[model samples]
Target: MSRRGYARADRPGRPATASAGSAPNTVYPARRSARACEGAAVGADIVIIGAGFAGAATAFHLARLGRTDVLIIEREASAGVHSSGRNAAIIREHADDAAEQALLHAGANVLRRGELAAFDRRGLFIVGPGQDEAARYCPRASGRGTWHPDDGTIDVSGLLGRYLEGQRVLYGVTVLDWTHGAHGLTVRTTEGDVDCRLLVNAAGPWAGEVGKLPLTPYNRHLMVSTPMPWVDGRWPVIWDGYRHFYFRPESGGLLFSCCDETPGRPGVYEEDPKILDTLQQRIETLQPALGAIAIRTTWVGQRTFAPDRRFVIGFDPRDERVFHVAGLGGHGVTASYAIGLRAAEIITGKLDGRDDPFGAGRLF
Candidate 1:
């Protein structure tokens, strides 16, 4: 549950603070292992290894901190192909820890500041006899078992777009290998090679495979109904405390989740027909209108977690030049801003005294 240095928000040619590695701004004069160096050094001062929320957030913060010559790379053709893109898009500004509360609201603040706030302050409800644990989220309960007025929905895509517009990104770039050199690393990729002073492993589920971290992939499903004309699409999202089912309104219909989190590998996965059957069997009592409505479609996404269900952000124990920001089980979208800034701060050697609750040092 430790979060710390993920990127050294330093700009190109700036004296790097990395100890285990050096920032050799000079071009790689050495011959390429396969092809010759085309013209300019095909590398950046800092290379972000993933294009998901973590990568995008770090890129945005790094740019905000005035870092140029930085590159954000993604294996997918577009951003948010994994956890971020597939999130429920809820801005849950409810947590017990004061710092966590700040981080949660900061994410919502970024959305609102960027004009991407189409929120439902009516409240995020904790259904089915909410537990005492729910009391923290539902501070101002009107009548429900539990309700969080501060918890609202966000335009995740819009927020991401706002940050992505100013950064240099390369999509469809598959990172193949990393061979440590004199003072940095030569990253082998499907497209070509990139020599950089620093490398960030924000590769999400692939973090374990890429950076020697242990992460377990959990599969979750979401189903959308055709349309429930009678039901209000504006109603706040409902989450069952124990049943582990959740639903929110979207596009004239409701999106439902079995609250299913199954262990699996990263790839396209089929819908669990049993989850659909469960919804069909329980809809009568859950919501007659939603039950009456036919399910339009279903899909699956993977959420990754470490042994502890918290984020892993910081430098590699042995290699200071290499950093990681993965194992963000389900908090990727909710705490993207805070996590991103902290990671960038640590990497750039400007931590500004933030506590390291989710720091990777705890594991290393």
Candidate 2:
């Protein structure tokens, strides 16, 4: 519904053990002044940077908890303009580790149970051409409890639209700087400044540049096709284990992804033309029937990853008032709710180091 506020009685607990006397690692020189804008001066209990799934979910969880003084700052003209909107939108119960698996399962349940909203479950299929790749996707498939020959796809656009409807989002506003002090955090944005006691850095790909955080970037790509009903809309979300290619149904057409990982600088990145050839070859090997499908349009997006691929959630190591909720890579859509709840719990002191494996200490 609306943006969430902070709890009156239950403020954030004592700063975590690791946050004491720590300072953020500065990278570049800070801008000298704030930007001019028009708006009533607003203050929030929590200020989240980024309007992607991670930030939106955090705002939703906070509202559900009856904490309403939350504001989300997004750089784009609308929400989900980047990775959140660019993804294949497949919800999977599979994870690489116990902690992540739990979050994945929990998020999948939220989608299936209609907690986020009514979502169509076409089911996810991890097609493996050989034994090694099968072994890799098997645990995740087994954990999901459903495996089918057809490709599974989720309605990502529908889910995001539903979740964000009627919510107060400051679109086209970019957070330029933030300072955490004894009083709380003061963030400067492209529009104006927001003063809040708690801050969540749910800024997906640009998380590393958002207020001096320790986040790494990874490269990924996705492509869309012309409307083709012949390609079974019910095709299970296909992952060519051998070629690292994946595809899912979007609207009536098919959306394919080349699971390409490359070294690069972080920011909104465009796709390389060579990736199209790579995707075509992979699709030919994995699903021969769809090889003939024409590629109507294509684009690329960065999938930011942490050092361990597990999410980095919890208070900032250097600043207790600043929180980190990022590094979802391709799992942001699947793990959004769980991660948001966990971040809110940490912010409100409902959860501590003992409750989450994604604590900031992991980065140490």
- How many steric clashes between backbone atoms does each model show? 10, 12
lDDT, each prediction: 0.67, 0.65
Q: Candidate 2: global Cα-lDDT?
A: 0.65
Task: Compute the lDDT for candidate 1.
Answer: 0.67
Residues 103-213 of candidate 1 have per-residue lDDT tens digits of: 767766665444642445545777655454433442221223666666667766556655565566666677887899997999888877788999999898787788877
Q: What's the distance in Å from true for residue 73, model 2?
A: 1.4
What are the per-residue Cα lDDT tens digits for candidate 2 across 1-364? Answer: 1122211211112222212111111111111122311232476788888777888788778877778778777777555666776666677676668999899878877777664555666656555433333223322221122354222345554566554544455656678888766788788876667788888888888887774656667767767777875655655565553457767666477777778887557664655769878877876655555647777666666678887888988887777788888888878888888888888777776777544688876776
How high is the lDDT of residue 127 in model 2? 58
Query: What's the TM-score of every candidate structure?
Result: 0.80, 0.79
